[model samples]
Target chain A: MNDETLSAVDVRDAVKRYGDFTALKTISLSIKDNEFFTLLGPSGCGKTTLLRMIAGFEDVTEGAIFLYGDEIENLPPHQRPVNTVFQNYALFPQMTILDNVAFGVEMRGNSKAEARRRAGEMLELVQLSQFSSRKPSQLSGGQQQRVALARALAPEPKVLLLDEPLSALDLKLRKAMQLELKHLQRETGITFIFVTHDQEEALTMSDRIAVMSAGELQQLGAPTDIYERPHNMFVADFIGETNLLEVSVDKIAQGRATCHLGGGHELTCNQVDDIGVGAKVHMSIRPERLFMSDIPAEAESLKGTVKENIFAGTDITTIVALAEGPDFIVRTSNSDRGNKRIFEPGTEMYVNMEMGAGRLLVD
Target chain B: MAGGAASGGSATTDTYKDARGWLLMPAWSVLLVLSLAPVFMMLVYSFLTKEFRGGVIWEFSLAAYDQFFFDRGLFGDDPPVIEWTYLTIFWRSIWQAGAATILSLLIGFPTAYYIATRPENVRPVWLFLITIPYWVNLLIRTVSMKFLLRDQGPLNDLLMSTGLISEPIHIINTNLAVQLGLFYSYLPFMVLPIYAAVERYNFALSEAAADLYANKWVTLRRVLLPAVKPGVVAGCILVFVPSLGAFLAPDLLGGAKNFMIGSLIEEQFKGNAGNWPFGAAASMVLLTMVLIILLICARQQSKAGKEV
Candidate 1:
C-alpha cells in the first residue's frame, strides 16, 4: 500500500475468544483514512468486540491488527495513537470541561499553557466555551457527549473509535448529534470507526458499513451497496425491509438467472455468482421495489389476492398472498397517482418487480 | 362553620410543620447535655486554680496554662523559663498519630482496592471479614499485642527459633508497640470508608483516562486518587483523632515510658499527680486542636464536593 493511501486501520483474520466462547471469529477488513466507517450489528454480534480489539481494550485471540501500517496488537491502549468516546461518555466528574479536554494533550507531553490553549480551542470548536470551567456533572447529556468527542479529538489521533456514543440520547437529540458527528468527522478529516446497532443512523452517517452477525461479517460495503445489493439472506433481512421468496434456479446466463418461484411461476433476477443451476435459492425483492397493478403488465407477472392493506401516512403497504405461496408485501408511496387506484383487503392484484430490482441470494 | 373548619385545618398544618421542626430536638439535646456539657465544664475549669484537694478552686488563675509552657516560676519573681517536657509529649503524640494515619492509609488503600476489584458476588464476604476485628473489643485487641510483642512472646520465639536473633528482643513497652496496637485497633475504621468510596466509584473513568494516553500510574494519580480523596480524608480523620487521644494502647503497651498526651492527662486527673486544673487545660488544648483539624477537613471536603 502507498503511504499516501495507507489504510488507517487493518485487521488480518482477527479473532477474539473468551475462555471457551468465541466472541469474534476470523474477521479481516480495512478502514481507509479520512473515512467514516461504521460497524453495524445487533447486541452481542461481535461489533463491539471488534471495536474494543481495535482500541486495544481486548486482545486478539488469533491474528493481528495494524494501525497506519504498524502492528499494534501488542501495544497498550495508551501507546497507540487512538482514542475512544465510550458509550456513556465517561467524562471525569472531578475535572472541568477545559481540564477534561486538556488531559489528552497534557498526557502527550504538551506544556500546561499550550495544552490549556488547545483545550480552549477544542471547547470553542464544540461550541462550549462558556462551559469551560463547569464540571461535567453540570452539563446536559448532549453537552457531555460533545465534550467527550472534543477530548478524544484533541490529541489528533490517527483514528477515533466511537462505541455507540449517541445511544444514550433521546431520539431528537440522537438525530441531531448524528449529523453533527458526521460533520465533525468531515471537518477534522480523521478516520472515524463508529459502532452502532441502529441501521438508519449507519445509513445516514457512514461512508461505509460492515454488517456483522453471530461472530461473522455478513457484508461490508458502502451504505447504498449494502442496502441495495445484499450478498445473502442475513444481509438482505438485516439491512432493511424486504420480501424473501423461496425459489429454485432454472438457468444462469451472463449476470442474470431464471428462477422458478413457488407455484411454478418462472421469473428472472440479477444473480450473483456461485449460485448453480437447479439449486434451491432465495430471491430478495424489496417491498418498495414491487409494483401493484390491476392487469398483467409483464409476461412473467404473478397474481395474488390482497390479504391486508396498511396505511402508514407516507406509504401504503399491500400484503398479497399467492395462490400457493407465502404472503408478500408491496409498498407504494401515498402519492396522488397511487391514491387513484386503491386496493383494499381481498382485492385481486398482479405484482411485478422493477427491472434489475430482484437479487438471488448465494446462500 | 366552613371558615372555622378552614382555619382549624391551617392550624393543624402549622402544628405539623412545628412538630417536624422539633423532631431533631431529642437527639440534639441528648448530645448537648451528655457530650458538650462536660467539655464546657472542662473549658471553665482550665482557667481555675488547682486546690490542695482532688478538685479545683474557684479562684481564676493562669497558672495551669502557664505551667503548660513554663515548668518553674510561672508567676514567681524569677524569670519564667520555657519548658519542653509537656510540649515534647504533645509533639510526640502528634507525630505518632500522623505516622499511624500514614501507615493505615498505605495498608488500607490497597486492601480497599482489592475488595473493590473483587467479583460482585464475593465482595460482601470480603467486607464482612474486614469488619470481623471490630467485634472484638479494642482493649482486648490492644492487650493481646503484648502476647505477640513481649521478649519471650510468640514473635520473639519465632525469631529465635529461626536463628535470626541471638537473644529475644524487647518490644512490649515501647513506642513501636503502641503504634502497632493503634494501627491494629483502628485499621477497620480506615478501610471501611475507603472501601465505600472505591465501591461507589465508576471504573470507566479510569479507562477513559487510559484511553487518553495515560499509563496506570498517571491514571491513578490524576483520576483514581482525586476521585477517592474524600474517603481518604475521612479515614485519616477517623484514625488520627482516636490515635492521638489513645490511652489504653500506650498505657498497656508502652508501660510508663511512652507518656502520650492521653496518658499525661490521665496522670494529672487520677494518678498520684491529682492536678485537676492542669488536666482540664490539657484536655481543652487537645479538643481545640482536634476541632481545628476537623474544621479544615470539613472545608476541604466541601470544596471538593463543589468541584465534583
Candidate 2:
C-alpha cells in the first residue's frame, strides 16, 4: 500500500506458449516487497503458468521478468533467489522433516550443520520444531504443508512463491493454515506470492489480487476495491454473489446516467464509459445491498416472487423469481430476522437497490 | 438367541464360499511335495554307492561324493586325486558367466533408462522392439551368431577389407566368443526387469531430487540407482544362472576344448563316462552351487527391501 516499499518483482509483457497454444498473453504487473499478492483464477486460466514463470520453473516465450531491477528471465530455478512450495507440497519422502527443510540451503553450498541450524529455526517459526526427526510419510497433511512452507522459507528467499499450497488440505486445516500463513508473512516480513482459485481465500488473504480469466488479466486491485468496484460484469460476478439485472440507458448527462431495469423500474446512476442511451446495459448489485420489503412499497421498487429460502448459518439466502427472466438471490442477515420470517416462498416481495450500491455496465 | 445363532452360521458360510476354500489344503500339500521332491531325491542319491554296472546301489555310501572331491580324471577306477579338472571348469564357468552378466547390465541399464524417459506415446514402441528378438527361436539366434563371427564370416571380411587386420580373427573357439554368445542370447533377460522397474518409476521423484539441489550424478547415485537396484539384481540373476547352465551357446560358438560344467554333465550322461551315478552326482554339485547363489540373492533382496 505504501510507495516506499521496494518493488520486488516487475513482470513486463510476459507471454508464454506451448507449441501453437498460447498459455498466457502479454501481461504486465509489479509486486512490492513484503506484499502478499495472489493470482486468483479458475483452472486453465494460466495463473499457475504465471506463477511458475516467476519462480523460474518455466521460461517465458516472450517478454522479460525483473527481480529488484535485475532481469532474471534466462536464469534457472536454482539460480533465482526464489523458492516455490509446489501444489502437492512436493516434500521428499526419503528425507526427514529436518532434512527436507534444510534442502534449499544445502543446495546453496552451505555446510550441513549450518543448513540444519537455519532450517531448525524456520521449522520453529512454522511451529513444526518437534517434527524434525519424523519422515514426511509420518506427518499429517497439515504438518507436511508446514514443512513445505518452512523448506521454502529456510533459504531466506527474496520471494516465496506458493502454488495452491493449501489446496490439498481439508477444509478445516485449510482455513487454519490460511490465518497462520498470513501471520507468518507478517512476522517474517518477506514477499509472498500465493496462487488460488478460491475467491474467498483470495479476498481474505491477499493485499493485492490479480484476477485472470482465459489467459488474460481481467482485473488487478486490492481485495476490497476489486470486489466492490469491479471493472466489468465478469469481475463483479466472479468475485462474489451478485444479481445482474438487464437494463437500458435512456440518457447520459454530466456524470449520471438514467437507466431502466426489468419491469419498467427506472434508476439514475453515475455513467460508465461505452454505455449509451437506448443501448442495452446491466446493473450489478450485491445481495446485501438490496433491501426486501414484505409487500408492495414504492414506484422505484420491483416485485418478485420468493422461490426458495436457504438458511445459511448467520444469513438467509432468499432466491426470488421475477416475472421476466432468471431468479435473483438476496442475502438478508440474522438481524433482519423478522422481515425474512414474514417473507416465504410463493409470497410476493419488493426488491430495491440503493442508488449508489449498483454498478452500471454496457453489455 | 436366534439372531446370534443365525449370524454365526452366516459367518461360517462366508468363509467357505469359494471352491478354493475346499481345495486349499490339498493344493498346499501338492505344492509342498513338488518343491521338496528334488532335495529328497538328491539326499537319497548322495548316500547311494555307484556299482561297476553303472547302476546306483542304495547301500548307504558316501564313497561317490568322496571320489568326486578327490578324483581328477573324468572317468575310470584309478582316477587321479585333487579335482583340479572340475575346479578349473567351475572357475572358468563362473568367470565367463560373471563377465556376461556385467556386460549385459552395462548395455541394458542405459537402454532401459532411455526407454523409460521417452514420452508416453513412444514408450510402447521401444518396449516392443526390446521384446521382438524373443519371437525368433533361441537356438536359431545362437547359431546365427556363429555364422556372423566365424573365421570366414562377414565380420572378418569387413575387417580385412578395412585393413584393420591382416588375417581373419580366430574368435569362434575362445572363451571370449563363448561369453559374447552368452551375452547376446540373454541381454533381453537383463533388460525387461530393469525396464519394468524404470517404467514404474515416478519422474516426480527425480524432480524432487533436483529441487533438493542434487546434481545429476548425485541424483542418479542416491535416488535413481537405489530405486532400480532390485531390478538390476533380479536381471543379473536372470542372466547369470541361465548362462552358467548354458551348453548350447558354448557348444555352438566355442570348440570342444572350451568345456563348462553343463557340458561336463552332458558328457558323463551321454558321452564316454557311461556312468549315470557319477553324472547325477555332478548334477547334484551344480545344484548345490545354484542353491548358494540363489540364497545370497534372496538375502540381498530382503535386506534392500527392508532398508526402505
Q: Name the top TM-score candidate.
A: 1
Q: Which residue pairs of candidate 2 clash? A: none
What's the TM-score of each model vs. the native?
A: 0.90, 0.86
- Tens-digit lDDT track for model 1 on B1-308? 99999999999999999898699899989999999999999999999999764788999988888988897767788888887998898988988788888899999999999999999999999999998978988778877887889898999999999999989888888878888888887988899999999999998898899899999999999999998988899899999999999888889998877879998888788854578889999998899889999999899788878753
Strongest candidate by lDDT: 1
**Native contacts retained per candidate?**
0.79, 0.26
In model 1, where do residues sit more than 4 Å from their true spots? A1-5, A248-255, A258-267, A277-281, A307-313, A321-324, A335-342, B1-15, B21-26, B37-83, B150-172, B268-277, B305-308
lDDT score, residue A38, model 2? 96
Q: Compared with the true structure, what per-residue lDDT tens digits does model 1 show for residues A271-344?
A: 67778899898989999888878998674578899888889999888899988777888888888444435587
Error of 2 at A209 (Å): 1.9
Instruction: Name the runs in model 2 displaced over 4 angstroms.
Output: A1-7, A274-279, A294-300, A323-326, A335-342, A361-363, B9-22, B25-43, B46-64, B67-84, B150-176, B254-259, B272-308
Compared with the true structure, the alpha-carbon lDDT of candidate 1 equals 0.90
TM-score of 1: 0.90
TM-score of chain A of each: 0.96, 0.94
TM-score of 2: 0.86
DockQ of each: 0.62, 0.31
Residue A107, candidate 2: C-alpha displacement in angstroms: 2.3
Q: Which pairs in model 1 have colliding backbones?
A: none
